[model samples]
Target: MNNLKYSICFISFFFLFLMSMMSMMFMIYFIMNNMVIFLEWEVITLNSMNIVMSVLLDWMSLLFMMFVLLISSVVIFYSKSYMSSEINLSRFIILVLLFVFSMMLLIISPNIISILLGWDGLGLVSYCLVIYYQNLKSYNAGMLTALSNRIGDVLILMVISWMMNYGSWNYIFYLDFMNNDLVMMMISFMIIMAAMTKSAQIPFSSWLPAAMAAPTPVSALVHSSTLVTAGVYLLIRFNILLIQSNFLKILLLLSGLTMFMAGIAANYEFDLKKIIALSTLSQLGLMMSILSMGFPDLAFFHLLTHAMFKALLFMCAGVIIHMMNNMQDIRFMGGISFYIPFTSLCMNISNMALCGIPFLAGFYSKDLILEMTSFSNLNLLIFMLYYLSTGLTMFYSFRLTMYLMVNDCNLLSVFNLFDEDYTMLKSMFILLFMSIVSGSFLSWLMFNYPYMIYLPFNMKMMVIYVSLLGGFMGYIISTMKIYSVNKFLVTYNLSNFLSLMWFMPYLSTYGLNYYFLNFGHNLLKNIDLGWSEVYSGLGMFNVIKKYSMMYSVYQMSNFKIYLFSFFLWMMIILIMLLIGL
Candidate 1:
């Protein structure tokens, strides 16, 4: 009976999601018809179409929305069974529905304000789900994640303010703000900061691995389908801004750094979920780097393909973890391929897609990224870093897979091998099917279709061979336990260094806090704690300070003074009005 209830809820939520997608499609069709005259406001000076406001509806937005719907639906299906045993299953379902709806709204939002509203909604729901465990540790992780994302939100709000002051909030008004160099620069930087935070770039990324405190379904949903992809989607939405600021070069550099750092971090992680988490960051960085080169189509292609394979991998990991009674550390897992052939096989296929093996989904998208790097006259050092990061991806991907399935001597024996849940297996099968086929179809649609879609440059045989060699060498090194060479290579140390630098900005914020506190204390010492002295000089103030009941009242009233004072009231009202608008 409980199973039936769960199934009913899952199916109902999925149906609503489908309806939402259909509605969005219908809206897109209508919007496209009036694309050239969709004015921000119908001016009253002349109620005529002559004052037309042009809005462009290219294939890129359509493609992004399609992928968003596809991944959201799959996540809902996967989570149905993955979260079945949890006590708050109903609450989980509600959050999942809200997440899908928010993502859909974000993707098709025609104006910046609508986009931000959807973005904040998605961020809030993600925070709630992350802390679903309700433990101290999970709660802390959720708080940190929310804090990092709020910083991004602040940056986005600044951009919105710039837009309001110059261009209309509608994206079609980009041209109007293009001439204002200072505002354009500010907007560009803010958008990039938001993307970095959303996508879990470097220092802002620790929250991702911490987020593994949530259920596997939540990890799969947030990592592959909805939350992190919001950053990439933002880049696609603001492609015009990227092109205008020549910010692509800076983005490319950051993406390369993030990719390299994440790949190295994945190697040090023993937790199965953390390994996948770091890999997600690396893959996202690669896709963002490709997009930064002005190839939105390539980025979208990779994003779609990555979602399929990564979701499959996470589902397979969930099965293994469930069978092991929630043991997540990879060191405790080995030689289970024979026990769970279905999962092992699915994992292998997904791993192939992840590592960009030829003829797999990852191969097509990764090849496009590599091809782009080869053709562009980017700095040779930057190109080398990109290539090496790709190699590292192969190493860590197969290293985890090999540890689980291949190393017989290291196998962690399974006592209850047949204890697999039917619903979980069913979800895994669905993901496996999609992981195998989605890539080729997306590639064909992007490159071979009769559209104005752009393709990155093709690589020659030599470049392909070198990339293959690098991938193979990485795998060989991982297998042979070649630590000495790896140590000398400095990739690991470099990753740590870069991560430290990436985190410097955050650390500096704390440093500033420390400095201010110390400075305030010093100033107080120089003033001889004058406030206390003043209270001591006045008999009534001194009596109140010494009296326990009076001190309690003072403490209680402190909060009121902090919040309800005249200046604070004005600030609160101003903020409320801004948000309301």
Candidate 2:
């Protein structure tokens, strides 16, 4: 009976493992032969317009699918232990598998219709996963998460409409031809908007943090690997069209801001999962910004590596939260390594990789990205945002370590601590191993011929400088108690502004609807219920009837004949002339 809980995990892991192995095999063959497989099944054709289902197979899709399957396999294995106590364990695994399927559809589709199918599926499935716990927090976060992605869904639908002008919904075929077309301008703008919402860029980022209300496995899968990266993946596939555009410039700016703001927000966050969620936001910004820099390959490289470690980080957080009775407040968690050595080991490595520590999965991609940014012709603001965000990455990584490792035991009771679950630890170790090696493996595999980098020692030192400052700040911030200093209390306003994510959550959700809602209320009060009625049949009749009754009173009083006759000729003439005209 107990073994039944692992049935879904076992099947999913076995299937994904086989898929990953096959994808890897195809990846090698495609790289050597430069081969692609294209399959299309027409859904309908009317008046020379076509909508079809498609599958595009190439080195990129194969490689991405390989990683996706690999990660899903590991996550499913991990969930066996993570969700063992839940009655509906099979349902949770099915949702995860469904998410993986949606991602797969997205990864391979060359048709816009198929893309939307996958895109909407991701949003829908993720919403279900987010609100799985059936609580108010989960429900609200689920709505936010669902609605934010729906914006992308809507934009894609609009793109489908606009693309109808081209007589085809397969965007891949039109990328190079439509690069300079005037009609493409709207399409490009909509695409960027869609990508921004899915990637959780500025003003659309509230959902990412709020989505932490989901179970940890959902967080690891949705935030770290599949759902969020779908936008970046879409952009990557459409890179030829987007490479030369002002939209990319705007995207570059927003991505930089997202990275910077999310990093700062993470430094102030107390909830462990929320902090990790914010960190994922910061990294998403990095990928988007780099992709905007016209290097989708590098961006994709980082995306794969970030997935490995970030998933591991969340899994570790899940383990900690589970151990601490599902309490995710980092303030109540201190020196936990003393209790769970294995979990702590995994957590520290993941945190280190997240900071782009040398020789780790993050190092290969992150260091390359920073160097590339430095070499680009960027304005001062963007340059600062990138560097500062990088430092903040290190800062928060250090801060998280301090809170979870360096402080005294902060748990309410020590007797409840346990981390001996092999099911969970086994799943985590798989990701941990990947986190250590995935960057190096992926870098060598993707870029067998390395590009040359020419720069002075000072120019190269920028990342190091920011990282050191960030680490120092993280130590100080995490080590110092918030109530310990009077100065911190004095600067509460400024701190609160940054801490509350610059009120971005408020701005994106309630703030966005406030004006529209107020306008609707005013319309209902003054227009629909008031002036609309007055202009309608009964009200208008009442108005005319009152005037007519007054005139009747005058007529009855002998002055009526004179008063009516005074205005009758001109008014009657005007009405007769209007009717005749």
Candidate 3:
């Protein structure tokens, strides 16, 4: 059985790698030749209109598929080592493969029906993965994740039903029709909402962190590339419709706030995996906001680059977590660089890449995004969100670094920590290389010409200045002072509110749920058992029984009085007859 599982993992890794290479080749061909292939198979005809299943093969789709495959390939390989102790290793591997397949289906399809299939697949498989540990936290997290994504699934279903007016579900073909028709554009709103829920933006953002209850390998895959990015990818495909729509502005505001919110929240987070998860959420916001600003390409660029490094970061964290005996608190982790230098080095590199350090994978995409933001004629709110979020990214990244690398060892004097797992290192090395180089490689390959930007020197350097300031603040804040009072205690409530993702989880879970459940309980008490009983069957039966009993007693006690009354009535009638005569 063990040998069979190993073979399954190996076969999956090889198959994914092969597919990735093929996807890249196709992506390049499609790009060079400026080509797209659309294949449609007619499923049925109604009212002289065809319902067809369609596949869209183009540069963008192929490129995204390539990245997804590459990441999944390495992730599956990484899991072989990371999940080695698990009894159901083969099942886990198969679930990951199914997830990648779903994503691929989503990437290639032009029809909303096909998209729904893949979208639902992702949600279902992810729930399985999240609840894999069979614990309360995992179960709760899985429920949140599944139900949150189900919102998107429902919205897509609505979109499909609405699209029926056009006699087709191929969204790519009818984007223009929907763009011109006001009533049709309502689908765009639903689409945006669906995407937001899937991406976990703003009000729907609680599930992303909750999802960290999954295995680290799943986190590395889902948070970084496949699951979360599906929403961004969907929007990217629909960018043409959004570019001219008024709803894009709303998306921009929400995405910016999401970016800012996640950034601030991460600074207050202590769980190592959750910090990275929040960072993923922040970057997702960046992608979404940029896409909303009418640059799907930049969003796509950042999405790809982010997938590389963020996956590496999670893999590194998994190694650390594994070594730390499942301890995810950064407070308990400090100065293990000496023990596991390779893992530490990889983590630092991924963290720096996350901070958008110069010339690294992130810089190539992140710097471009900020420059584009500066160039665009956006409002002050959005402008501040962009820069402030950038600084907070650095702040949290450095704080994390200090806690994990710079500070004194907080663990016991003796512990075994080493980077000797060659399988894990090999997988990390693939992502580590990609994390360093994928940004520049993709930028050069994807863009034939550079964007023109004329910015003042101060504005151009704003990212650097903020990054340095954030780094300084992060270092200072993480530093412990024995004599100093705890600031978090002084501002306890405020800290809790901010740290707990603005109580979003409660709002999404218990807040709304409590009210709804309370309403049901009230109905049970008042209507089902209270007023309903009084007005209907049981209460009415009691009333009728009481009245019947009262009449029976009156008849039984007053028989003689009744006879006398009858005789008096007859006598009065006879006297009236005589008078008439």
Top candidate (lDDT): 3
Residues 261-330, model 1: lDDT tens digits: 8887677667899889888989988978888888887888898889878988888888888777678877
lDDT of each: 0.74, 0.90, 0.91
Write the number of the candidate with greater TM-score, choosing between 1 and 3. Answer: 3
Error of 2 at 93 (Å): 1.3
Task: Return the lDDT, model 2, position 159.
Answer: 93
How do all models score by TM-score? 0.78, 0.88, 0.89
Model 3 stretches astray by more than 4 angstroms: 43-51, 412-414, 481-490, 521-581
lDDT of model 1 at position 393: 79
| Candidate 3 RMSD to the real structure | 7.4
Q: Which digits, one per residue and each the tens of the lDDT, describe model 2 over residues 439-504?
A: 999998899797877889988988888999999988877767763343555486777778888898
Sort by lDDT, best first: 3, 2, 1
Higher-lDDT candidate of 1 and 2: 2
Ten-residue segment with the worst summed lDDT in candidate 2?
481-490
Worst 10 residues of 3 by lDDT: 481-490
- Candidate 1, superposed: residue stretches over 4 Å from native: 1-8, 16-59, 175-181, 409-415, 448-581
Report clashes for each candidate as comma-separated counts: 0, 2, 0
